[model samples]
Target chain A: MTGAPMPRLPTGIAWLDRLTHGGIPARRLTVLLGQAGAGKTLLSCQIAAARARVEGAGTVFAALEEPPADIIRNAAGFTWDLAALAGEHFHPLDLRPDPDMVFAGDFDLRGMLATLSAKARQTGAGLVVLDGLDTVLGWLASPARRSAELARIGRWLEEEGLTAIVTAKAERHGGPADALGPLEFAVSLVVALERREESGGTLRALRITKSRGSAHSSSAHPLFFSHNGLEPLMWPGGDAPPASQERVGSGMARLDALLGGGYLRGSTALLSGPPGTGKSTLAALFAASICAGGGRAVHVAFDEGPEQSIRNMRSVGIDLAAHRASGALRLIGLQPGRDGPEQLLSEILAAVETQDATALVVDPVSSLMRGGVADLGQSAVRRLVEEARARGMTAVLTSLVEIGEDPASGTLSAVSTIADAWIALGYAERGGERNRTLSIVKARGSAHSNQTREFVMSSEGCTLADVYTAGGAVLLGTARMEREAEERRLETLAALDHQRRLRALEAQLTEAELRQRRSALESEAARAELALLEAAEAERRAAQAERQARTAASRSADTPAEEGASA
Target chain B: MSAAAVALFVAGGAPRSAAALRNLTAAIAATGRPEGTFRVEVIDVLREPGRALEAGLLATPSLALTAPHGRRRWFVGEFDQPELLAGWLGDVLDGEPP
Candidate 1:
């Protein structure tokens, strides 16, 4: 367990070896433990082939449960040339127990160990694997016997300077150590493989339960074994990618404003809403915007198939299909009951790696929880967001609030908590009309509009518009229209009244002007008549004067005579 | 040499085993044979354990290749890689299958 770090023996699966800090330390006993169907035997063969091909190390594999032919045949399926590598660098020994063989008194793995040892020595093998040692170990009567036998095997392997990998079935319900018991302590490394339920299927993961000589990742990293081989799913360094200061637009311009520009690049946003409340539409819009900006995006749909999703989003003015065709976007659909959560995460990672995706959309993360692994679903989603953000990609996820459930709580509620920004969409009814409304519940590291704005969905896309709350209540749809109509009516009435008053004032002004003009005319008329009369009078007077003068002269003559008479 | 057909039976417990079938068939097909010259069948032993037992398949991913010349080859474990399976098949018939 101690010494200068043993020489690293790479497992040939890059991620697996990386997590192990290097493969099993050379010439040390390493135990690979998993359930009955965890593919331990296949892994053993892969190890043999890898050691033979990569390190050019002489290897020997002892199959305890499977026949050598089956091992060779199955190895071929993985493209391993086990047979050719054998007789020179690789030696495979079949150790299936015979049904006819009668056990004499005390049956132990001594005979098996002897055969394995002889084969290793004969081939000068540096690496050896005992596939299905649990079956042999299980035959032992007691834990003590198991411990002794494991110690004996460990010592022998060490003495021969040969690295040995032993496969064992994990206990159904116990600590990881239960599968190996004392043997777990005997081995220098213990790798446990398990299958976990995802959305519609199962995912395989591996954990380094123990590794003596090197620091190894103890996390249960997702495992992939194809015709290829076994490896972990975790990104190296086991952390999210570095955050970027740049911001990317969410398709809707108004929504971008609500989000303080747009979602920050490499940030995670959760859009939670009731069904038919445009949750998916928002995610699609984000993806479409990314695609439009010449950035690649990946959309994983759980509620519908890619075709249906594409059609549905297209109807909302988000042309996901076009982006998909142009290779700027990838659309993946998972059936809740048909695909596991781990499987979903792996495909997401594949998209990120293969396409160098800068944006990801998982519509209705709630559907993934239908697999009943709510916690696992959250973890998987968190990892997806982390990986996307780590690579400076923006991830927009949607979760549907089931009917009658609180809009804020769902299977992926944790997503809202982990997301850098959270947006909630819901239906608001006012005066018998239902309209969608969006609220920015939380936006980390940025100022965001907290007002509940009206959300409109159309073939042109989604937009957030001002909501009228003039009446001490938020108005939407028909109610707002009605209020607007009423205001217009009042405005028209007031304008008419204003016009009536203006006309009356104009009439009064005209009348006053007429009165004043008439008065002046009357006065002028009077003056003119007076002047004419005066002139006439004067003429009369003058005429009279002339007559009077004449008469006066005559009167004077008459008056003078009368006056002389009166005097 | 005569034509041969291979049947691979596996338990559904291991997801990798199913993936292995694809590689197994690809190898058998890579022998320069005409289409339909040989057939490879995959049987999920979990669903048809009775049939698997009748065929004497003892483990998951058991393969039994039966040639028209009364030649039968059986193997166990992961043999999805082509080199060894093809080598064994070539050596068994000494050439191409009919």
Candidate 2:
């Protein structure tokens, strides 16, 4: 309620404090207990590395488990020059319990503490971090001893007003018994780093397991391990929502007619379909149209890079590279969901502002879905669309829908909820060749042509021609419709010759059964069969007997009689 | 540390990065603590700047932990969490909430 009464909360990381409540409690020692690879070292190093200029209170990093070289390597990943912190104010105390002694029974943490305390006191350091507690605790003769040591360390740091943090491995730690263990105990603060599979990639997560002394920021920051170290993700919200901008057309005549007039500038349209549906080509053509209409467009690709996308679009007669060179189109190829949703959102916003983009396309929002993060991605993508809309830029997102997934999967459904318009694209065989069709399913507040438009990409570029009034029904979602059409064609052909399909089915079934029988027989022989099978008696002898004889005969009893009888 | 360098570094995911910010505030608060004129409440917003925004901060690297009751004032913008928090504490408990 009232302002925090502590002297001042010194956040180990300044940039983190910029996103946190204020800082960790100034008088209490917090424990950042997390899983391995949760970025504990990264977080601690940032604090340790910042001390050279932290002012008044010096900081010491007591790295006991990791050798100085490994520490340096890890710090380097965070882009920190730990060596530069020496003397000017930063100090790294290499208190590594001997690697050999780490497992020995005679490990004394109190002595290590004494040395650390002396070093901290001498430097007038206010912040101290035991690079982690697990390494040191494992040195303890017993879990009880380990627990006692942490409790003592916690009390000393809290009483001395030396803001401290002891990094610990996140496993089954202690309980509410004393001042030790994981989240169940009473620590001034607790931070957990967890690596979660997200969008098919690993997401670095920083969860505030607990923060006791004062009110704290209670959000889990989506984090990433980068060349520099553990970085917190920015918020998904755009810097400042862009005021509504002008109206803009998608530029594909048939596609535009389907969507009433054209897409609203800043509105979000979702394009969903399977491969060969021309998702990328459609996006490229829209981008080209925007460029031709006197506005800039940016394409941030995840499926393919700029070169491939440019080349492919050129095959369709849309020369994106030209537009790029002319300054009307800016294409940035991003690695597949290489970043979390928030990070991706920031990158888009940053790119848009830097390029003064009036329109943007993310070709295959499905790329955002591939990273192992299932639930968060949908929200993140939706937020991205919202951000694009807020920035007053038309956002056209392409999604890959497996024929089976179109009707049921929650991904596109979630995306559909956020889209201002829905367009379905697919390949349909008219003669003996496949042609692409772009159908607009919904467009809010606009009169969309109730027709599926023929879209083609040849040596020139994407072209929208005639609309098909009787393409069966537009919402068959591609695969089913194609399969049904193929069935009808086959039926017509079969009407002329009924026996062809029957013979085909019988032969196919016989071939399949024979294949299964042969495979099963071969595997059984490989497993234990030794005797050669006598075709006449094979049916009488069970499969088990056949296997044993086969396996045994293969090794011994040149037994040409057994083989001859089987033949 | 250069502000940009610190930012890029903290954004890297250093948990201790917050400790450094806290010590910064405490150190400056220590300079002013002897007088016991005002207390500072600091929140590390590195993982949750939404909290910073809730406090009405539009830009990060900006501080809002000040009050001044009505008499004095607080301004936000700095790379240091502690040192910056003090400038605001001087306003808090003395003026209207920021």
The candidate that wins on TM-score is 1
**C-alpha local distance difference test of each model:** 0.72, 0.62
Which RMSD values do the candidates have, in order? 17.6, 33.3
Residues A395-433 of candidate 2 have per-residue lDDT tens digits of 899988886664446677888777888888877775456
Tens-place lDDT per residue, model 1, A179-255, is 34675567788888887555545567777888886666577776654434554444555656456667899988898
What DockQ results for candidate 1? Answer: 0.02
Error of 1 at A133 (Å): 3.2
Return the DockQ of model 2.
Answer: 0.02
Q: Model 2: number of clashes?
A: 87
Highest-lDDT candidate: 1
Reproduced native contacts, each prediction = 0.00, 0.00
